[model samples]
Target: MDFDYDLFVIGGGSGGVRAARIAAAEGKAKVALAEESRMGGTCVIRGCVPKKLMVFASEYPGLVDEAAAYGWEASAGAFDWPRFRGHLATELDRLEQVYRRNLERAGVTIFDQRATLADPHTVRLADGTARTAKHILIAAGGRPVRPSMPNAHLGMVSDDIFAMPSLPKSILIVGGGYIACEFACILNGLGVEVTQYYRGAQILRGFDDEARGLIAEMMRAQGIDLHLGTNLVEMAPAEGHPERQPTEFDAAMGMPASDSDAAGHAAPAAPRGAPSGPIWVKATNGSERVFDAVLFATGRAPNTPGLGLEDLGVRLGRNGQVVVDAYSQSSVPSIFAVGDVTDRINLTPVAIREGHAFADTIFGGRKTAVDHDLVPSAVFTQPELGTIGLTEEQAREAHRIEVYCTSFRPMRTAFIDRPERVLFKLIVEADTRRVLGCHIVAPGAGELIQMIGVAVKMGATKEDLDRTVAVHPTISEELVTMRTPVRTA
Candidate 1:
């Protein structure tokens, strides 16, 4: 039963890299990993690292305004996109090198090519070579998918935002998810005219209703033209603009043929690196407008296509996600999958935990399993949102609950006559007095939730929180001081 390696990881993302590193360094097993694109995958390369930097960059203008309100002499200036983008590229490059160095130090072999399942224990690479492993791990992660519509390819995905040659003067962002909302806020903060279209009644659909409502209100106040109950109907390259012509790179990037090209007439390919032109879009609400750019934050799909998993009898979900058990083991005994590829809690931290647990179970002999329940998360909107456990709607359905809620302008903003408000809500089970959920909408909500999450994870009761002393003059102190139930269900 000799094999190429003890374990072969199909992705070099946070999940796959952790598993590979642990198996090699701690488990004392031979490991190897293959990554077609960048070594750090989505989080470091595009998703979180770059996005968070942009979030930081976008916040400076507000900080400058707030500084003036605080009696400090400060003025805002235009953001230089090229300067910031260049720094971001350098940071990403440094991070990728770190990932590679970590894997090498762990004694894991690196393959800079696409890898696919050849058999239960074999992987085929893009270069017509195959390798066998005693165990195979699939953690190829997911990709942002454009909506299936004509001229949709002209629109950029979240990944493309970091690479734009220059910021658009005005942009149309489509979708209601966190990605869409975050970008809407980011672009708006960066001085872009941002129009957001979501077919849903409200944005951040799965979040706490009150928190999301407040966020929607703030987004509009911040000058994002957010239009709920609306969606893009028709889009095309605006006529009379030869600069809007499609290019060979666009075709290679999966842009479909135009109507003229599909009707047996091929349009000339624009030169490489040509700046994209304006897009004319008609919405379902009977409005038409031209935008400098269109960004589709619609959704993402698992990286399963052409992997040859189903052909080898591996079970896959409707969304092309690999189906795995409690320990991340796939239907095939020799195969395993983790991260976004499994469609379970697609957050980067969750993926890392899953990967570590998989390695512990398979190689460390620890038999660890990830607890997916009550995971805390944050959405980095203008005000930020942090939540853990159930939403109020979700908690109300299953338990007799007491909701402790409060909303008011914080001292920092209130002192300056700013209208911004903060909300703190706790959903507690009436009988047990146990906190069922916690949601916060304010600056630093993400940092606040992480500390609060520890208590919630330890099964802290409402009484337990109340007994704790409040940190005076701090907004989070309200978490402990709220004594009255706003409502009981």
Candidate 2:
């Protein structure tokens, strides 16, 4: 059947853009992409790029102190948020333009508006325009979701952090995931009083336990008020309202007492002329404090609402993610989905790969499917974390495994008497001797994991790693030098 275009891509995120570009340029198929927001999606515009830049900015103050320890006179002044934010805005604008130009060069038509499925092969833009296509690809990505609670809107999410006009003097970060932990460290390094609340026993769950424990310890040492087994009970605006006073009954329940009026009664509402102020949060642990802001990195959901997918009989998961086959094909033959919207490996690179594979299969006449296993990932906290393959716990559950681990202060910081330490661990299948997982907790772990990922993907065995010569005086050298098994499971 004749169509407006050979392919119509909805949501100009990393995945959608790649699919459109590939289908148009390589497959010689006409393509069009519509994006309601910026062209580069979460990774380029708001998530990775801006967050990493903030990570770099936050590190300087700590570096200045480290320089002082190294016999150099260096001291950090107050962070210039306005200056940095302005520069960040400019950089994001430049990146968005780059995405547009690349798509245009690939001969993919760009629509700077929202588009949603109207039928199996039709997309309706925000305007009253309907476009038909031989095939449609959905890659709308995901969004941060506020918790289902009272006054949850008072807290900001990860995306809001990039556009904040000013950094908060004190922030209450809520969550146990990478996003929450990273920002907790970022704010703390920038000299903000960072109080983190994670209801879980440990942050970074599903990671190697030892590594998680070490990161938690380092975060606390760096002055993050990380509270595990704790969560927010309630929060309200702290203007004119007297703080909740603690009663003897509260003390008996192990709740901390308030320093303010100890009347053991509820505070009155804000008065008419009361000046605006910070947030008053009461946690499950019975501690109450005021913070200039609250950040909720609780979770994210796929961008499927109002997209008209379910109306057309597209299968969606419990979390609103598009359910797809190995090749990213949805229930409808003419439709496909990828990226965070599919709830697969939700990394930007993974999405790009999925998009490329989709184009290759449907348009280029080369059937392709993305291998979702062993994708390397990094969490950009103060001290970064990088992991590939399975966690030690995951490996132990499935296979007889040998674990080799090492932890010590690196020379650079150890020389300065810093308390920071680095951890390197490898989980190997006992029978096959192949490395099943690698986890590293240290500076530049992200970069290191990328190189190590190649070896692990190629099915490198423990002996192969051992045979490689160690790079002397390097933190990563421990990866090759560790011979004795820490434990067998």
Candidate 1 per-residue C-alpha lDDT over 285-359 given as tens digits, one digit per residue, 9 for 90 to 100 = 999887777888999999999999999999999999999999999999999999999999999999999999989
TM-score of 1: 0.95
Model 2 agreement with the true structure over 311-400: per-residue lDDT tens digits:
999999999999999999999999999999999988999999999999999999999999998899999986889999999888988999
* Highest lDDT against the true fold, candidate: 1
What Cα-based lDDT does every candidate model obtain?
0.90, 0.88
Error of 1 at 80 (Å): 0.5
TM-score of 2: 0.93
**Any residue pairs clashing in model 1, and if so which?**
none
